[model samples]
Target: MAEGLFGVHAAALEVRSQRMGVLASNIANASTPNFKARDIDFTTALNAVESQPGGVGADLGGAVKYRVPTNPSMDGNTVELSTEQTAFAENAVQYQSTLAFLNGRIGQITRALKGE
Candidate 1:
């Protein structure tokens, strides 16, 4: 069940991954004058996701705290392109790695089924 996988290493990794995407988006728009840099509090989001009874990893990000514009931009653009890109790339790689692991696990299960 996806629920069982929720607390598993793979699931946790996936959750972090999605969070990374959000962070990247925030960073990318950091210089957009008015773009609000968005970041998810991972621990809190995960807990909220877990609290849902149906399953795990099913609930999307619970609540996003738009980083307060400590420095208001005159142009209204808040994207920090370079920073966001770097974060996005890193998150993408991690997400891919986790996906590969999960795929391998599924393959092993398939082999076992065939053997049986």
Candidate 2:
């Protein structure tokens, strides 16, 4: 019932949350030598989730890939602080948006159930 009510927003939130973690990790390892910055292909992951039977608990690991640096660092670290920070900020916004959508949906359901 909850799944039907929320549809893909729940899965989208999960993907956005995971993406935030990946981006944050990249930022944290920006100075670590040879640390390959990784990120998920959000659209692909969300599509994978929607295609699955339950559209939940979908494995997103396959969507994660190492980012190719625009300019290779001398130390071989692929993480660029500026890029990572931007991605992190963007993903955070997306996560918050998804959360808000879910909250609104829940409120609607609650009101309906209350006969209001």
Candidate 3:
């Protein structure tokens, strides 16, 4: 019952959290030479998680792919400051949203258990 309650949102939260780390890494490496920006494909990851049992951490990052920069850099660095920052901010928001949803679900479950 607990497992059913959590469902895909739980998996989404985990993936979003992991994605935050990846995005942060991209932002941090923006100026580093030859550093390539990378991100996780959330849809693919979510699908993978839903398809298999005990799939929370099962190849969670197998869908990680490199970002294609809009502007080419001479230093061979793929991390663009603007792009990385934007992606980071977006990912952060999504992470927060997912956390909020999970929190709400937990609250509902708690209330139910308490007969509220």
Candidate 4:
């Protein structure tokens, strides 16, 4: 029932949340030598989640992958600060959007339950 009410937003929120963590990690490791930046394939992760029953307990391991840098650094770190920041900002926005959608849906459900 909850899944039906929330639809893809629930799973998307989870994916976005995870993605934020990955992006943040990349940003955090920007100066670390030999640190290979990683990211989640959002579409793949979302699909995997939606395919699961109730969109729960979906494994994101397959979706996480190393990000290839546009320019290889001498230090062997794949994390480009600008790229990581951009991705992080984008992911943050997406995460907030998904959260808003879920909140709105929940509010609607609550109102309906209360005969409002």
lDDT of 1: 0.64
lDDT agreement of model 3 with the native: 0.82
Query: For model 4, how does the per-residue alpha-carbon lDDT over 1-116 read when each residue is reduced to its tens digit?
Result: 76778887899987888888889999999999999999999999999888888666678899999999999799999998999999999988888888988989889989999999
Local distance difference test values of all predictions, in order: 0.64, 0.87, 0.82, 0.89
For model 1, what is the error of residue 96's alpha carbon versus the real structure, in angstroms, after optimal superposition?
Answer: 0.8
Output the number of the TM-score-best candidate: 4
For model 2, residues 1-116, the per-residue Cα lDDT tens digits are 65688988988987888788889889888889989999999988998777777766778878999999999899999998989898898888888888999999899989999999
Q: Model 4 Cα displacement at 28 (Å)?
A: 0.7
- TM-scores, in order shown? 0.65, 0.91, 0.89, 0.92
Q: Would you list the rank order by TM-score, best first?
A: 4, 2, 3, 1
Off by over 4 Å in 2: 52-57
Root-mean-square deviation of candidate 2: 1.5
| Candidate 2 lDDT | 0.87
> Candidate 1 — which residues are off by over 4 angstroms?
5-10, 13-17, 20-33, 54-63, 68-72
Point out the worst 10-residue segment of candidate 4 by lDDT: 49-58
- For candidate 3, lDDT tens digit of each residue in 1-116? 54498878877877787788888998888789999899999998788777777666757667799999899799999988887788778888888887888899889989999999
